[model samples]
Target: MPAFQSTFDALIQSWKLRLQDAEAHETKLPARMETCIRVCEESLLELRQWVMEHSFPCRECEIYFFKQVKPVIKARYIYYQKIHRLHTGYFNGSGLLEKERLEKELRELAQYFTDNDQFFSYYRNGYTHHDELFFVRGQYDWKICPEVNHFDDLFSTSFDGKLAELMAYELLMKYVDGMLNPSCKLTEPATVTPSRSVAVSRLQCTASVTDIVELGYALHAKGFFNDGKASIRDVMTFLSTMLQKDLHYYSRLFFQIQERKSNVTKYLDELKAGLTRYIDQLDEQDQLK
Candidate 1:
């Protein structure tokens, strides 16, 4: 689940009751949504502190291994934080432009992670809106599971047997598995050079905006996920840099993937056609000016 908290106390209690009365779960209430988060947070804090204090490593009979894996573990912490934040936002509000803005961020983040949509920005979007509804195309175990006989029964049942799990959840779980096992594969990241050469030779002005963005994503996704440097200082640096930058040029050249049609590839096509027509008409008007 792309949920911020791994398990809420209410969620856990719900699971317990689900095992007790699977059908009556709709009526089974939780203390509060935050209960689970608070529990998860305290548990994780203890666990991380233990790891840090004892330096426990899953592999290698040495504490040195924990040092190497510390980054990965820390990432899970951040992932949980993001999940909680979005979970709160959904119940509360993320402001007016947050959804669209975060959607764009997630799509771009997907490029870096190369379709690892679970931790991607849009994953946050889903958590913050529509009660964090995620849409999945396939029956991936982690992303989509259907509620069936019982939540407890799922451990014994094959993934195919469950229908209550959301498809998005299953897929997102697959992404998480990829993070863990890395047999978990994602697409390669890509980029658009914004040069005329590729436009003329490859895309031929007919390439769709989705195609261009996909290409860029494919290029960029090949790289590793960069969850570092996102602290307050880094955020301040980014904002300061952004304030000095040109949004119009960047928006036209890059940052408009949400619409798919605002990509430079689309702009080039319209501009080319319009310029050709304008030049032709201007030549006819040469009779006057």
Candidate 2:
């Protein structure tokens, strides 16, 4: 699981870096959007191929992948596609006309939410009573399932795509609101204390981010921090700042770790072996002395 997750995280990170670079260098909005759309399509294709080749270890892992992991990636694809369509029709000179169009689209999005209020509430509230039917493969309930043009029983669930759609709509709403009121967009505050800066500079992680993420999760699972009072998010944030690596998608990566076929604690096992070997070396030195 760690191997596959590390590969997947690397793939996502590479594309995200490319997208960031494109945004920085490309002045044209359409060209940048094209790059984003192409990258998303490529990612989805690779994910589909992986799904086709691998069998999940169990139903729960499958549910987590489809419900939590896959939707995130799919939501990005849907967002870019929708944004591309919206921008292609954007009116540059007529502010009033564009505002009207955006408002109409907003209303439509609201209507979609109203239509799926029950499922949206279920998702928003973190209810998992219907996970088996909504996320598991081939558990589609026709009476409740949304209309999908193309359904792949092997790779898709009844509600995963809809879940992606809901997430995409959220992004769209924020974007459209930004367009409507540019000042409403929030910006991250740039402030760093000198003491904190010194602390971060002194600490460094030589291992890969995936390795660090694995270690962070293990620590969290074992209640190593603050006697289990610390949340995973808190732990990952502390590690990220200390190690100078972004662990934004640690949960998705951890999901992949959970789905490992064998040796699920690969990193933890390696850590134990390395510590034991170091102790053995110390004993040999003592014998030499």
All models: lDDT? 0.35, 0.76
lDDT tens readout by residue for model 2, 1-289: 5544564677678767877887798797778778887877787788888888988877777887888777887888788888878888775775333877886776666667666778877887899999999998888777878884147887798899999988888788667655653432222435879997797588767887767888998897898866776666677777887678877545445655665799888888999999999999999999999
Minimal lDDT window, size 10, model 2:
180-189
Residues 1-289 of candidate 1 have per-residue lDDT tens digits of 2132232334435443533452243342232323433444554454445435653232222212222222223333344444445434544253322445444444444443433334333332433331112221121344344333222221222221222122323333333323322232233435546684456355323445444433334333443224331222222223234233212111122334544554545544665788999999999899777
lDDT (Cα, 0-100) at 19 in candidate 1:
35
Give TM-scores for every candidate, taking all chains together and pairing residue i with residue i: 0.25, 0.59
Screening candidate 2 with a backbone cut-off below 3 angstroms (N, C-alpha, C), the clashing residue pairs are none
Error at 45, model 1, angstroms: 4.2
